[model samples]
Target: MTAPTLFSPLKFGAFELPHRVVMAPMTRSRTAQPGNVPTALMANYYAQRASAGLIISEATQISPQGQGYSFTPGIHSAEQVAGWQGVTRAVHAAGGRIVLQLWHVGRMSHPVFQQGHAPVAPSAIAPNAKVWIVGEDGLGGMVECPVPRALTLPEIQAIVDDYRRAAERAAAAGFDGVEIHAANGYLIDSFLRSGSNRRTDIYGGSIEKRLRFFYEVVDAVIGVVGPDRVGVRVSPHITQRGMDCPDMVATTLLAARRLSEKGVAYLHFAEADWEDAPLVPEAFRRDVRHAFGGAIGVAGGYTLDRAQAVIQGGWADWVAFGRPFIANPDLPERLRQQVPLATPDTSTLFGGDARGYTDYPRTA
Candidate 1:
């Protein structure tokens, strides 16, 4: 039999991934009310996509203050842990490996979403963009992001503790591992980007300083989950929600090299915004691959052929699919069979029930 390309087995950290395809972390805002707990519907949704080598759950808030959107699952409280237990149970029952994505929105949150509290960040700077918030109508809505208060040194340390606690809770909840979401304009990403972090303290200024916050958080998470079971996500060129690195090459290279030194499980890098951005330059990909000795997973607007080429070329160890996995629940099966994918319904992408969440048809 011919060897499988996308279906080939691979080793990522402690787990032996059955395939090289991972379900990327995506926020759907469908958790249950009052504490943003994961629902039974979410369990069904993840279980349905078990064929992938691994599943990274939606970016989950580490604490109440970490939340920037309504109805998203959290891993802080006992109730939240119990809710995710159901999700992890379902995924494991279907013979799939799953990881909980730990997140903090920082200035990407509105006071309304923070329950009348100000948003927090490494520095007090307003993102030149907007964030999705819950409107007065009790539905998902958009609001201009407000200037966040620069966190005090003590508060910054506290947030690191929050990540440690969340990681411990994730393991107790039965997740195979945890992915630190240091990407996509969140708190850690904000600190890493010079445009967002304007602090004068040791946590800002030069590249080494800018990465201090991330290093602390990673240390805390690894202390809880161990380095072998923790992965991190980063997006160097993605200027989402008003985040842009002045020098993409320098910033990403520094971040990648630092992460590699930490000895985390894997590094998931989204080279560009998916909509209509340019492909990551081959040279840049190769540079990152060389910098980070650990496993690498690349996402954003990748097709089967392109993904296979990236893996075969040694640029990345695995490929993650976001929209493709959402629209095609059995994406791995479809790719193996060489079938066309179903179009994603952008209308039902966020703030919906199970219609767009779990109702995507599986291949027969």
Candidate 2:
């Protein structure tokens, strides 16, 4: 039997991908201001990288209350939906498949983004994290997250409805699918972890309860987009932003099994990519594989060799490249041809214009 390489074709849900190189969602913070809507430049940026098997868009807030960072796009408003239509049209024109990543930051948000109201979470705990906010001078910097107020029971139900509406808007915006952003210590991630979710209600306590909010949101999204057009991203080993959950791996596995039962299109693991971050254990990967019969994708600091190895090992069906995709728009081709990858400018990463976002020279 031959080993599957990174260049292997993959049939992920309704999309027949030409290769296994997926473009991970990255927040460039270059959206059109005032409404935080997707721009034509953003559409160009995505079209430039259209060769990837799949492109999971940057985390787009589901509502005004879901926003945590400055200039990040949203999916709630009619104008926002129309803006994203241009983006989708551009990507489709370039022969690419793209999905919008639905997001809610939960307690990882600052009051500025919340219109002076405290951010909402499963519990009233601060994430001890910082969100990037651009100051009046247009200089973006990290600001500490304050202790948030807990969401009321009614509010929790409302949030579930928010997920459903967001999925509907995503479909209207012409997205091929929607990837629920339940990772990176965001809203859904907070509820899925025991350490963060101290709620004693049906939404917290035991592992099953801790997974309630996540399941509700996922179910709501699936109801709108159907299971085949839904994908979920989870991070079991990431302990940053006060997400130091002891049972995260177990919780993630449980979620995977249920999502598999729901027949989701795929499960994407957003592995911690820091130099000192804990490695996602192969044992856990095996557990997820056993639990999830659908396509599996992983994103971290994966190079071509590592991606090939993981795919060949049967732990993952595809690989998502983040930072590498920023600098090399034709990253899949570069990896295929074994060319050197370009480095992205860190200074221009967050709130910049085209210099770092779309001006990267392609060597094809």
Candidate 3:
């Protein structure tokens, strides 16, 4: 079977993309520290890769309490929203579309980012993950995540309101769309899995209750941006974040069906990419396709060949690249031309200046 080229045009909601390659949201932690706001340099960085069919911005914290690391941009502040305006304008000026990834780290956080307050989650349980925090000397390193304070019912409702406000802020920042970052064991992901959500309230317990928080959030955000301009990201295979609950698969599949019923733009799943990670089962893919009527996207360490295979097999509508897009601003053209690939310097992947960022030279 002949596979569609990476440069093939595709439909993402109401937008018609020039190609199907997407820039996956990656946390670079490069925003200005004092304000945790986007910079002109960051604008230049995303503009360089504006050729992608869609560019999902780095995870931006929805509120100050939602922050988990140093130097991460936020969507809750005026300065941050203005800063993102430049990013969206740059991408649009370069003839591209962009989506803001709304994030709340939940229990995957340290007190440093939370202003001495413990991170909040659906339950008081911990994820046993290390979060990056700046020490007294201003050097960033991983610190143990503490057991979070369980959010009260009212607090949970307020958080959903925060998601709505963040979506409105994203629109005010001139973004074409918004993506709910419910993946990778964040706040929403914590609520979806039994491993973390052992609560007895309406927000936990049965699978239906576990997904209540997610549904409320989706409904709130959709009210602001409309379902056509909205998307949700989910990861059903990540165990590193202590999210491997017994019902993880069933829960995420149900989440997909519910999102589809709501008529959102698309569903994106972050496949496990570890060296020996288990592949996403074909059965899961078939069920996901049948359960969701909209387009589906897959993101991970996908190469040209594997990406082509997935598209050819009709399993995914687009392939989002992470590390590759870090160094290859013109990734779509690079795949189209079959040229030499550039490697990303792991050292500068996190918080840093433009040294390992916009400085990466693009191929003509």
| RMSD (Å) per prediction | 1.8, 0.9, 1.2
* Model 2 regions more than 4 Å off: none
Best-fitting candidate, scored by TM-score: 2
Give the runs in model 1 whose Cα sits over 4 Å from its true position.
Answer: 1-4, 274-276
lDDT of each residue in 194-213, candidate 1, tens digit only: 88988889999988898898
Better model by lDDT: candidate 2 vs candidate 3: 2
Model 3 scores what on Cα lDDT? 0.90
RMSD of 2: 0.9
TM-score of 1: 0.96
Which digits, one per residue and each the tens of the lDDT, describe model 2 over residues 278-340?
877889889999999899999999988899899999999999999999999999999999999
**lDDT sort, best first:** 2, 3, 1
Q: Candidate 3 vs. truth: CA RMSD?
A: 1.2
At residue 33, give the lDDT of candidate 1. Answer: 82
Write one digit per residue (lDDT tens) for candidate 3, span 273-314: 878988998898888888887878999899899998888788
Q: Model 3, 238: alpha-carbon shift in Å?
A: 1.3
